[model samples]
Target: MRQLLQDLFDKRVNQFVSDKRSKKLFFPKAETKQACLANRSAEIVKVKAAGKIIEESVEDEFQTIKYQAHYQYLIKQNGILYMEEEMEDRLAKFYKNALVMDEEIRPILESENDPETELNHLDLEDHTERLSYAYDRLKAVQYAERWWNSYNPAYKKFQNDCTNFISQCLKAGGAPMRGYPKRDAGWWLQSNNWSYSWAVAHSLRLYLSNSKIGLRAKEVSSPDLLKLGDVICYDFEGDGRFNHNTLVTGKDANGMPLVNAHTYNSRMRYWAYEDSSAYTPNIKYKFYSIIDE
Candidate 1:
C-alpha cells in the first residue's frame, strides 16, 4: 500500500509539474525580462542561433530536460519525499541557467501581491502575555532529541514525520494541544491519531497563522531572527503550498540557525538548504517565534 501510494503520488506530481513547466515561457514582469536577457545575452543568442529556434522554445526545451534529470536524481538520493524538493531544485536551477530567459523563470517567483496572504503577522501582539511568558529552550531541545531518537517510545510515529516532530518540540516548550480526535481541529496528538495541524505542514501553517487563544506565534521576517526552539516551515514553491517543517536546535557562530527534523532524520542541519532539489528561487519560508507560557 505504501508503495502504491508512493507511485500514485509520483505520477500525479509529475503531471502537475509538467503542466506548470509548460506554462513557464511567459514573463510576468517587464523588468524581469530585461534584466535576465541583459545578464545572459550570449547564451540567449547562442540558443536562438543554434537551431533557429524561437527563444521560448529553446528555453522550454532546456528547462524540461534539465528538470526531468533533476527529478530523477532526487529520487535516486531521497527516495521517500522527493516530490516537493524536486520542484524546488528545478526552480533554483531555472534562474541560474543562461539558456532560460527572465520572463520564462520569473513567473514562478512572482507573487499574487495580495496583502492578506503575503503579510507577516504577530498574533496578540499587544497581549499582556509577553512579560510573564518564556519558552523552555532546554526542554524543547531535550524533547527534540526524544522525538529524533524515539526516547519517549510512546508518541505515535508518522509517515509524514516533519510536522509531527515539530509539534512534539512545541509541546515541550509549552504549546497546548487543545483539540483531540477531530482531525480538522487545532493541533493535538492523541494516542494513535492526531489533528491536521499536528501532522500536516500546510494545516499547521494555517493553524498558527489564525491561532487566537491557546498557542499562537509571531511570524518573523527572516530565519536569522529565529532562535533555538523557534519553528520554520517551508513552501517549496513560491506559492503558499507548504510541505515541510523543522525545529531550530542550535546556531552557528555566524548566527545561522541549525535545524533538526524527522522525515529525513536530520540533526542540527543548516537551515538554508541550497543544495537540495527542494529549494526554489521563489522558495517562501515562514519563521515562527513560538509563544510559550
Candidate 2:
C-alpha cells in the first residue's frame, strides 16, 4: 500500500513539473490543479504525499482497502513560496499484492434548497433585541486554515461537512448563534443538536439571506468583493439546491479568493472550483460578505 501511494504521488509530482502528461495516469485532477496554479503564475516546487489505511479486507488473494492520502505542496508565486495541503479518500483493490484499481470517493450531498419542498422559515424568538456583533476576519481565516484538513473534536463531524465547517469558521469570528431547538430556524449548533442552517449548505445560504440580526450577511454581487471570512455557496449542478460551501481564507496575486473547505479537505484552493470533479458547465455561486457592526 505504501509503495502504491508513493508511486501515485511520484506521478503527480512529475506531472506538475513536466509539460508532457502521461495518459495512463488519471490526469484530470492534475490538469485542473496545474491550470489553477498557472492562473496565479505559480508552480509547485515540491510535492509530498503520505497515506493511512482506514480499512482493509482480504479474501483469498484479492484485497480491498480504503485509505486517505495527504498531499503537501510547496508552491511558489511571484517571489514567495508557501505550503498547501489536501486530503483525498480513495478505495483500492489488490490482487496477490499487485495494485489493480484505485478510485477517489467524491462527496455525495443532499438537496435541501427548494422552497417548495424544504423549510424556509426563520423562527427568531426576539425581534426587538438585535445583538451587536463584530466579525473578526483574521480569527475566522485562522480557524479555517487550522482545521481545513482535520475535524474538530468538539463538533459532530458529518459526512457532508462543508456547511458545518463554514458555520464553525463563522462562529470562531464571533458570530452569535440563535434559534436553537428548532431545526429550521436561525444558525446555531448546540452539542449534538443543531439548526439546519448550521450544517446544511442550502439552509445556511437561506439563513444568510434572510437573517437581519446576529450573524447575518449581505449578498455580494461578485466574488472579488468578498473579504476574508466571507462565505461562498456552491450549487454544483446550477439546479438551485446548494451542495457545498467554503470560507475565504486568502487571496491570490490577482486578488481572487483562495478558499478552504471540508468534505474534500482542501486548503488555499481557487474559489472558482472549475477543476473540481463535481464541477459542471451550469454551476452557480452565491457570494456573501459577512456583516459585522
Candidate 3:
C-alpha cells in the first residue's frame, strides 16, 4: 500500500513538471511591446524634428526658432527617458512576483473564530512585512554597482539616467505608473503646442487626486506655497509661449524654491532661480502644488 501511494505521488510530480515545461515551450513570456512601440514612435518623431531643423536655411529667422529647436530636442530626450523608466518598472515587477501571496490573507482574518485562527492576523502582518522586505531587496538589486556597470551606452544618457533613478524611488515607495501622463520636449516645441503652465497644471491635478497625495488644485498658488515635489512652469515670453518646467526639490535658506529640470543647456540639477541659466526673460511663472495624501 505504501509503495502504491509513493508511485502515485511520483506520477503527479512528473505530470506537473511536464505541464510546466510544455507551457514554457509553447508560450514564451510576453514582451514589453507597448513600451517598445511607444519608444519607436518617439524616435521617429525625433528624427522628423531633426530633419525639419536641418531643412530650415532661411537667413532671416524668427527669434523663437532656436527656442523651438531646443524644446524639440528636449522632447526627444524625454521620450528616451520614458522608455528607460518602463524598463526599470518591468525589472521591479519581475522581482516583486516572487514575494506576492498566492492566497488572500484578509479572508482568513475576517472568517476566523478560534483563538488560533484569530492569531492568523499575524500572518497578514507578516505578508506586509515580507512585501516591504521584497521591495527593498529588489531596489538594492536594481541599483547595485554591477547593474549600473551593465547599462548600455544608449541607456547611459543623462535624461534616461535621471528618470531611471526617479522610477526606482517611486516603485520602492509602492507607487504604480498608471496615472501620470507621458510627455516629452517635442510636445512643447510644436507651433500650437500646449502651454507649459497648462501641462503642469493638468499633470498636477491628475497626480494629486490619482496618487492619493491629498493636495488639490484649488490650494495651489505662487506666494502661499511651493512644496517639495511641486511643479513650476514658465511662459518664456510675455506673449504666452509657455515652454519650460522644473520640479521643486526644496527651498533655500531664504525660503525661495529650488528646482530640478532638463532644458537646452541645463541638464538635470537642483537650481534656485538666482543661480539658474534657464530663467526666462520678461516672463511670469506659474506654480502648481502636489499634495501627498
What is the C-alpha local distance difference test score of each model?
A: 0.54, 0.83, 0.29
Cα lDDT for residue 202, candidate 1: 72
- The residue ranges of model 2 lying beyond 4 angstroms of the native Cα positions read 20-26, 111-117, 120-126
Cα lDDT tens digits for candidate 3, 14-92: 4322333243321111122222223434221221111111121123321111111111111223334211110110100
Ranking by lDDT: 2, 1, 3
Candidate 1 structure lDDT: 0.54
Q: Over the full model, what C-alpha lDDT does candidate 3 score relative to the true structure? A: 0.29
Local accuracy of candidate 2 as per-residue lDDT tens digits, 1-293: 56665676576667765663545435456677777787779888887778898988889988888889888888888877777778888888888777788788887776332233565555645477898888999999999988998899999888788999999999999999988787777778887788888888888988888888898889999989999999999999999978899999988766778899998699987799886788999999999998888
Poorest stretch of ten by lDDT in candidate 3 = 85-94
Please write out the lDDT profile of model 1 over residues 152-235, one tens digit for every residue. 566776656677788888888877666556666656887777766777777778777777667678898988888788888888
Pick the TM-score winner: 2
* Local error of candidate 3 at residue 237 (angstroms): 1.6
Ranking by TM-score: 2, 1, 3
Model 1, residue 7: displacement in angstroms?
31
Better of 1 and 2 by lDDT: 2
Give the Cα error of residue 2 in candidate 1, in Å. Answer: 27
lDDT at 109, model 1: 19
